[model samples]
Target: MSAEKWTPDHLQSAENRSLHLEQRRMQLLPVVDDLRRLAREMAAVVKEIDGIEGDIPGQAWMRARHVTKPLFKAADDIEQAIGDLGAFNTRYQRSYEELPQKRAEKRRRKALAKSGQPEAIESAPAGSGSPKKDEFEDVFDGLRQGA
Candidate 1:
Protein backbone atom coordinates (compact mmCIF):
# COMPACT_ATOMS: atom_id res chain seq x y z
CA MET A 1 0.00 0.00 0.00
CA SER A 2 1.08 3.59 -0.55
CA ALA A 3 2.79 4.94 2.55
CA GLU A 4 0.56 7.98 2.77
CA LYS A 5 -2.69 6.04 2.65
CA TRP A 6 -3.16 5.80 6.38
CA THR A 7 -6.63 4.57 7.14
CA PRO A 8 -7.89 4.04 10.68
CA ASP A 9 -6.89 0.39 10.63
CA HIS A 10 -3.27 1.22 9.81
CA LEU A 11 -2.94 4.42 11.82
CA GLN A 12 -0.42 2.85 14.19
CA SER A 13 1.79 1.73 11.37
CA ALA A 14 1.54 5.13 9.75
CA GLU A 15 2.62 6.80 12.94
CA ASN A 16 5.49 4.40 13.37
CA ARG A 17 6.65 5.02 9.81
CA SER A 18 6.48 8.76 10.36
CA LEU A 19 8.57 8.41 13.51
CA HIS A 20 11.06 6.31 11.63
CA LEU A 21 11.41 8.99 8.99
CA GLU A 22 12.04 11.58 11.68
CA GLN A 23 14.70 9.44 13.32
CA ARG A 24 16.39 8.69 10.03
CA ARG A 25 16.38 12.38 9.13
CA MET A 26 17.91 13.27 12.47
CA GLN A 27 20.60 10.65 12.08
CA LEU A 28 21.44 11.79 8.56
CA LEU A 29 21.73 15.47 9.53
CA PRO A 30 24.87 14.87 11.57
CA VAL A 31 26.37 12.75 8.86
CA VAL A 32 25.64 15.45 6.29
CA ASP A 33 27.28 18.08 8.45
CA ASP A 34 30.31 15.87 9.01
CA LEU A 35 30.64 15.21 5.30
CA ARG A 36 30.43 18.93 4.56
CA ARG A 37 33.15 19.71 7.09
CA LEU A 38 35.32 16.88 5.80
CA ALA A 39 34.90 18.11 2.26
CA ARG A 40 36.08 21.58 3.23
CA GLU A 41 39.05 20.09 5.10
CA MET A 42 39.94 17.94 2.13
CA ALA A 43 39.81 20.93 -0.18
CA ALA A 44 42.09 22.86 2.10
CA VAL A 45 44.55 19.99 2.20
CA VAL A 46 44.49 19.81 -1.56
CA LYS A 47 45.12 23.53 -1.74
CA GLU A 48 48.07 23.21 0.62
CA ILE A 49 49.49 20.33 -1.37
CA ASP A 50 49.16 22.26 -4.61
CA GLY A 51 50.89 25.27 -3.08
CA ILE A 52 53.91 23.25 -1.94
CA GLU A 53 57.26 24.40 -3.22
CA GLY A 54 60.62 23.33 -1.67
CA ASP A 55 62.55 21.86 -4.60
CA ILE A 56 60.17 18.96 -5.08
CA PRO A 57 61.11 16.74 -8.04
CA GLY A 58 59.10 17.20 -11.23
CA GLN A 59 57.83 13.56 -11.21
CA ALA A 60 56.90 13.70 -7.54
CA TRP A 61 54.99 16.98 -8.04
CA MET A 62 53.18 15.45 -11.01
CA ARG A 63 52.17 12.44 -8.92
CA ALA A 64 51.01 14.70 -6.13
CA ARG A 65 48.91 16.68 -8.58
CA HIS A 66 47.42 13.46 -9.95
CA VAL A 67 46.42 12.30 -6.48
CA THR A 68 45.05 15.70 -5.54
CA LYS A 69 42.86 15.72 -8.63
CA PRO A 70 40.81 12.86 -7.20
CA LEU A 71 40.79 14.52 -3.82
CA PHE A 72 39.18 17.61 -5.29
CA LYS A 73 36.68 15.48 -7.15
CA ALA A 74 35.90 13.55 -3.97
CA ALA A 75 35.29 16.81 -2.14
CA ASP A 76 32.92 17.95 -4.83
CA ASP A 77 31.04 14.66 -4.72
CA ILE A 78 30.73 14.89 -0.95
CA GLU A 79 29.33 18.39 -1.26
CA GLN A 80 26.72 17.17 -3.76
CA ALA A 81 25.76 14.30 -1.49
CA ILE A 82 25.39 16.68 1.44
CA GLY A 83 23.11 18.90 -0.57
CA ASP A 84 20.94 15.98 -1.66
CA LEU A 85 20.76 14.63 1.89
CA GLY A 86 19.83 17.99 3.31
CA ALA A 87 17.07 18.41 0.75
CA PHE A 88 15.70 14.95 1.51
CA ASN A 89 15.79 15.65 5.23
CA THR A 90 13.87 18.88 4.72
CA ARG A 91 11.23 17.02 2.76
CA TYR A 92 11.05 14.29 5.40
CA GLN A 93 10.63 16.86 8.15
CA ARG A 94 7.81 18.53 6.27
CA SER A 95 6.09 15.22 5.68
CA TYR A 96 6.44 14.30 9.34
CA GLU A 97 4.85 17.57 10.37
CA GLU A 98 1.97 17.07 7.94
CA LEU A 99 1.25 13.45 8.89
CA PRO A 100 -1.49 14.31 11.40
CA GLN A 101 -3.42 16.32 8.85
CA LYS A 102 -3.01 13.59 6.27
CA ARG A 103 -4.24 11.00 8.73
CA ALA A 104 -7.30 13.08 9.55
CA GLU A 105 -8.03 13.64 5.88
CA LYS A 106 -7.70 9.95 5.12
CA ARG A 107 -9.99 9.08 8.00
CA ARG A 108 -12.55 11.59 6.78
CA ARG A 109 -12.40 10.21 3.29
CA LYS A 110 -12.80 6.65 4.53
CA ALA A 111 -15.79 7.65 6.66
CA LEU A 112 -17.38 9.31 3.67
CA ALA A 113 -16.71 6.27 1.52
CA LYS A 114 -18.26 3.98 4.10
CA SER A 115 -21.32 6.18 4.35
CA GLY A 116 -21.76 6.26 0.56
CA GLN A 117 -21.89 10.04 0.56
CA PRO A 118 -21.24 11.98 -2.65
CA GLU A 119 -19.82 14.92 -0.74
CA ALA A 120 -16.41 13.35 -0.86
CA ILE A 121 -16.16 13.91 -4.58
CA GLU A 122 -17.93 17.24 -4.39
CA SER A 123 -15.65 18.52 -1.71
CA ALA A 124 -12.58 17.73 -3.75
CA PRO A 125 -11.46 20.25 -6.32
CA ALA A 126 -12.84 19.98 -9.79
CA GLY A 127 -10.75 17.66 -12.02
CA SER A 128 -8.54 16.90 -9.05
CA GLY A 129 -9.61 13.37 -8.24
CA SER A 130 -7.00 11.48 -6.26
CA PRO A 131 -4.92 9.14 -8.29
CA LYS A 132 -2.82 6.19 -7.21
CA LYS A 133 0.72 7.16 -6.33
CA ASP A 134 3.81 5.14 -6.88
CA GLU A 135 5.03 3.34 -3.78
CA PHE A 136 8.58 4.62 -4.29
CA GLU A 137 7.59 8.27 -4.70
CA ASP A 138 8.71 10.85 -2.17
CA VAL A 139 6.80 11.33 1.12
CA PHE A 140 5.35 14.62 -0.18
CA ASP A 141 2.79 12.54 -2.01
CA GLY A 142 0.26 13.56 0.58
CA LEU A 143 0.72 17.18 -0.42
CA ARG A 144 1.06 16.65 -4.13
CA GLN A 145 -2.52 15.55 -4.60
CA GLY A 146 -1.52 13.57 -7.69
CA ALA A 147 0.29 16.46 -9.27
Candidate 2:
Protein backbone atom coordinates (compact mmCIF):
# COMPACT_ATOMS: atom_id res chain seq x y z
CA MET A 1 0.00 0.00 0.00
CA SER A 2 1.02 3.60 -0.55
CA ALA A 3 0.79 4.01 3.21
CA GLU A 4 3.99 1.98 3.52
CA LYS A 5 5.78 4.80 1.76
CA TRP A 6 5.00 6.91 4.79
CA THR A 7 6.76 5.30 7.69
CA PRO A 8 4.72 5.16 10.87
CA ASP A 9 5.67 7.71 13.51
CA HIS A 10 6.59 5.03 16.04
CA LEU A 11 8.83 3.28 13.51
CA GLN A 12 10.48 6.55 12.64
CA SER A 13 11.00 7.29 16.31
CA ALA A 14 12.58 3.88 16.81
CA GLU A 15 14.84 4.47 13.83
CA ASN A 16 15.92 7.81 15.23
CA ARG A 17 16.65 6.22 18.59
CA SER A 18 18.63 3.45 16.93
CA LEU A 19 20.64 5.97 14.96
CA HIS A 20 21.41 7.95 18.09
CA LEU A 21 22.51 4.84 19.95
CA GLU A 22 24.77 3.87 17.08
CA GLN A 23 26.33 7.31 17.03
CA ARG A 24 26.90 7.19 20.75
CA ARG A 25 28.35 3.72 20.45
CA MET A 26 30.74 4.82 17.76
CA GLN A 27 31.84 7.74 19.89
CA LEU A 28 32.37 5.61 22.96
CA LEU A 29 34.21 2.84 21.12
CA PRO A 30 37.43 4.82 20.74
CA VAL A 31 37.28 5.93 24.37
CA VAL A 32 36.92 2.36 25.52
CA ASP A 33 39.80 1.28 23.32
CA ASP A 34 42.00 4.05 24.66
CA LEU A 35 41.08 3.16 28.21
CA ARG A 36 42.04 -0.45 27.64
CA ARG A 37 45.25 0.47 25.88
CA LEU A 38 46.24 2.89 28.66
CA ALA A 39 45.34 0.43 31.33
CA ARG A 40 47.50 -2.23 29.72
CA GLU A 41 50.42 0.21 29.33
CA MET A 42 50.11 1.30 32.93
CA ALA A 43 50.12 -2.28 34.15
CA ALA A 44 53.20 -3.07 32.10
CA VAL A 45 54.97 0.01 33.38
CA VAL A 46 54.08 -0.83 36.96
CA LYS A 47 55.39 -4.36 36.55
CA GLU A 48 58.64 -3.05 35.05
CA ILE A 49 59.05 -0.58 37.91
CA ASP A 50 58.48 -3.30 40.47
CA GLY A 51 61.18 -5.40 38.83
CA ILE A 52 63.63 -2.45 38.91
CA GLU A 53 62.94 -1.58 42.58
CA GLY A 54 63.39 -3.51 45.80
CA ASP A 55 60.66 -4.95 48.12
CA ILE A 56 59.25 -1.69 49.57
CA PRO A 57 58.61 0.24 46.32
CA GLY A 58 57.87 -2.98 44.45
CA GLN A 59 55.00 -3.74 46.83
CA ALA A 60 53.45 -0.29 46.16
CA TRP A 61 53.70 -0.59 42.33
CA MET A 62 52.33 -4.14 42.56
CA ARG A 63 49.34 -2.73 44.42
CA ALA A 64 48.96 -0.12 41.69
CA ARG A 65 48.46 -2.93 39.17
CA HIS A 66 45.63 -4.28 41.27
CA VAL A 67 44.04 -0.83 41.40
CA THR A 68 44.11 -0.67 37.58
CA LYS A 69 42.26 -3.98 37.35
CA PRO A 70 38.92 -2.24 37.65
CA LEU A 71 39.82 0.16 34.86
CA PHE A 72 40.48 -2.77 32.51
CA LYS A 73 37.29 -4.44 33.63
CA ALA A 74 35.24 -1.28 33.17
CA ALA A 75 36.65 -0.74 29.68
CA ASP A 76 35.79 -4.32 28.77
CA ASP A 77 32.29 -3.86 30.15
CA ILE A 78 31.82 -0.73 28.07
CA GLU A 79 32.89 -2.56 24.95
CA GLN A 80 30.51 -5.39 25.72
CA ALA A 81 27.65 -2.95 26.23
CA ILE A 82 28.35 -1.30 22.89
CA GLY A 83 28.39 -4.67 21.15
CA ASP A 84 25.14 -5.66 22.84
CA LEU A 85 23.44 -2.48 21.69
CA GLY A 86 24.65 -3.05 18.17
CA ALA A 87 23.32 -6.60 18.23
CA PHE A 88 19.98 -5.47 19.64
CA ASN A 89 19.61 -2.83 16.96
CA THR A 90 20.47 -5.37 14.31
CA ARG A 91 17.73 -7.70 15.57
CA TYR A 92 15.27 -4.86 15.87
CA GLN A 93 15.89 -3.84 12.27
CA ARG A 94 15.71 -7.42 11.05
CA SER A 95 12.40 -8.00 12.82
CA TYR A 96 10.94 -4.92 11.17
CA GLU A 97 12.22 -5.85 7.74
CA GLU A 98 11.10 -9.46 7.96
CA LEU A 99 7.38 -8.62 7.91
CA PRO A 100 7.17 -6.01 5.21
CA GLN A 101 3.82 -7.16 3.86
CA LYS A 102 2.24 -7.39 7.30
CA ARG A 103 3.63 -3.97 8.18
CA ALA A 104 2.21 -2.51 4.97
CA GLU A 105 -1.23 -3.90 5.80
CA LYS A 106 -0.99 -2.40 9.27
CA ARG A 107 0.06 0.88 7.79
CA ARG A 108 -2.88 0.75 5.42
CA ARG A 109 -5.25 0.16 8.29
CA LYS A 110 -3.72 2.99 10.27
CA ALA A 111 -4.05 5.33 7.33
CA LEU A 112 -7.64 4.30 6.90
CA ALA A 113 -8.29 4.94 10.57
CA LYS A 114 -6.75 8.40 10.34
CA SER A 115 -8.98 9.13 7.37
CA GLY A 116 -12.03 8.17 9.47
CA GLN A 117 -12.87 5.06 7.49
CA PRO A 118 -14.06 1.91 9.15
CA GLU A 119 -11.84 -1.10 8.61
CA ALA A 120 -13.27 -3.60 6.16
CA ILE A 121 -14.15 -6.87 7.79
CA GLU A 122 -13.32 -10.04 5.95
CA SER A 123 -16.41 -12.15 5.24
CA ALA A 124 -16.43 -15.92 5.38
CA PRO A 125 -16.89 -17.93 2.19
CA ALA A 126 -20.42 -18.70 1.11
CA GLY A 127 -22.09 -21.94 2.26
CA SER A 128 -19.37 -22.45 4.87
CA GLY A 129 -21.93 -22.91 7.65
CA SER A 130 -24.18 -25.88 8.41
CA PRO A 131 -25.85 -27.47 5.40
CA LYS A 132 -29.08 -25.80 4.25
CA LYS A 133 -30.62 -29.17 3.43
CA ASP A 134 -32.88 -30.76 6.00
CA GLU A 135 -31.17 -33.41 8.04
CA PHE A 136 -34.24 -35.66 7.59
CA GLU A 137 -34.18 -35.36 3.80
CA ASP A 138 -34.77 -38.49 1.82
CA VAL A 139 -31.69 -40.50 0.86
CA PHE A 140 -32.50 -39.75 -2.86
CA ASP A 141 -31.66 -36.05 -2.36
CA GLY A 142 -27.93 -36.75 -2.85
CA LEU A 143 -28.68 -38.77 -6.01
CA ARG A 144 -30.92 -35.98 -7.34
CA GLN A 145 -28.23 -33.33 -6.80
CA GLY A 146 -25.63 -35.50 -8.48
CA ALA A 147 -27.95 -36.09 -11.46
**Residue-level error in angstroms, candidate 1, position 90:** 2.5
Error of 2 at 63 (Å): 3.9
Q: State, as a TM-score between 0 and 1, how close model 2 is to the true structure.
A: 0.44
User: How many clashes in each candidate?
Assistant: 0, 0
Q: Write the per-residue lDDT of candidate 1 for residues 1-147, one digit (tens) a residue.
A: 444653444423545555545555566667656755765675556546544456555754465566556645664675566567557546654676677788888788778978999877666546685656764477776678966
Best candidate, TM-score-wise? 2
In model 1, what are the clashing residue pairs, if there are any? none
Best by lDDT: 2
In order, the Cα lDDT scores of the candidates are: 0.61, 0.70
**Superposition error at 101 for model 2 (Å):** 5.7
* Worst lDDT 10-window in candidate 1: 5-14
